[model samples]
Target: MSLFSLENKTAVVTGGASGIGEAISKAFAGQGAHVHILEFNAENGERVVGEIKAKGGKAKFHACDVSNNVQVTEIISAIGTQSYINILVNNAGIAHVGNLEGTAEEDMDRIYNVNIKGVYNCMHAVISKMKEKGGVILNMASIASSVGISDRFAYSMSKGAVLTMTYSVAKDYLDNGIRCNSISPARIHTPFVDGFIKKNYPGKEEEMFEKLSKSQPIGRMGKPEEVANLAVYLCSDEASFITGTDFPIDGGYIKLNG
Candidate 1:
């Protein structure tokens, strides 16, 4: 058998419409898994599914808000009724840029709702189906989960909770054959980054983009596809021996940056 082949498996990917989540959705479908994309952006979600289908891959788009427990549970239940959910990628999270003093109550609450509670909601919805058969859970965490980053208080707090949740779920469901893990990426070059730079830096977008890229020890920002490659391996059967680990695809920022 080909290594990391997900033939006949089913994967549910949150935020699968864009960036790293989009990359993971495509990669999973390319590997023969039937991909269920749960995205708030129906337009992008349908576009992705169409692209996958055009390439002869299996995929379906479901409009969903991961922060809502009832919505998430209902969608997962509908999907589960068709087949066992062999994988779940909790990649639907929003970022906040602010220090403690700069972060208002609503800022913290918004970050908490999407980043922390969203993960909980998706996992909670899918856990029972995973319990029926061995499965994989990959949460998108960040370098902030382990190290300090300026102006990221609320984002950091939510990611820290995600890291611990990975550990807890991995431990709690080991006997049931559920493997849980997280990926901590540093300065991924996504459209969101470009928008952030355009909005904040205005005329100096190039200068600010270069500065952000160079923050990684490797001297560049990471790619969404690179992170997706790692996600594929971790969720594949070849990685059955691994569980509860945090993989840093951070361009050496996690260790060499000091």
Candidate 2:
């Protein structure tokens, strides 16, 4: 048997309309899983589903705002009615760039709603159902989750919650045949990165990109596919022994940078 094959499994991937989430969704679908994308971007979500279907993979898109518990719950409930959910990738999140002094209360609240509470919302909606037959959950954390990063107070706070949540859920559900974990990626080269550079640095976009890449200590930024590959492995049955862990696909950023 192929160790990483997700054959006959059903995966729900939040934020799957773009970037790392998109890569994970496609990777899971390619591995024979029925992918359900819970995304806020209706157009992108539909397009992704179409692309996956055209490639002969099973996929569906649900327009969902992870911060909205009512909407999230309703969508998950509807999905549960059709398939036995096996995996959930909590990748829906927003980014904020500011230190504590620079961060306003509104910034903190916005980050909290989407990053911290959003993960909770999705996990809460799916846990009881997953308990019935066992499942895997992978949360998209960041290097900010564990270490200090300048100009990222709100983002860091939210990801810290994600890390702890992974541990708490893993411990609480030990007997339920559920495995929970988080992935912390540093400086991934997603379109979001490019856009941030373009909007913030403009003429210095390439300069900023290089600086960000070098910050990782690997002399380059990570690819979304690299993160997705790890997600695929962690979600597969081969990783049944893993739980309550935070895997940093950081290109040595966390350990080597200092």
Candidate 3:
């Protein structure tokens, strides 16, 4: 049997419309998992679902904002009736940039709503079902959670919560056969990066972009698929022996940096 094969598994990938989430969804589908994309963006969500179906993959889209507890609970419950979910990729997140001085109450709350509470809401909603089948949970984290990054106070706090949640869940489900892990990447080349650059440094976008790329010791941004590959391994039974750990897909950012 193929070690990494996810055949017949059901997966829910939050934020599955683009960037890292999209890559994870595609990778799961490629490995024969029936994936459901939980996203708030209807346009992107539909586009991703249609593309997967076009490729003869099994998937569906549910319009959900992970931060919304009622919506998340309803959607996951409905999905449970159709198929038992075996893998969950908590990739749904929002970005915020501000130091402690600049971080406002509203900014922190907004970040918490989507980044931290969003994970809490979704996991709480589906954890009972996950426990039934001995499932896998991979939460998308960031180097920001481990190391200090400039102007990312609220963002760092949220990711820190993600790492801890992974640990707690892993420990809680150890005897029950559920495995939980997290991946912390430094800075992947995603649309969010571009959007940040455009919004923050419009005139000096190229210069700022280059600075961001070179910040990593690898001298470039990590790719979405690079993170996806690691996610694939963790979600597979091949990694059955692993749990309660934070795997860093960072481009030598946390360990090798000066």
The local distance difference test score of each candidate is: 0.95, 0.96, 0.93
* Global CA lDDT computed for model 2: 0.96
lDDT of 1 by residue, 167-212 (tens): 9999999999999999999999998899999999999999998999
Q: How many times do residue backbones clash in model 1?
A: 0
Model 1 per-residue lDDT at 245 = 100
Candidate 2 lDDT by residue in tens digits, 1-258: 688999999999999989999999999999999999999999999999999999999999999999999999999999999999999999999999999899999999999999999999999999999999899999999999998899999999999999999999999998999999999999999989999999999899888988898887889999999999999999998899999999999999889997
Indicate the residue-level lDDT of 53 in model 2.
94
**C-alpha positional error of residue 62 in candidate 3 after TM-score superposition, expressed in Å:** 0.4
Can you list the residue pairs that collide in candidate 1? none
* Prediction 3 global C-alpha lDDT: 0.93
Please identify model 3 stretches exceeding 4 Å from their true place.
none
**Residue 27 alpha-carbon offset, candidate 1, angstroms:** 0.5
How close is every model to the real structure, measured as TM-score? 0.99, 0.99, 0.98
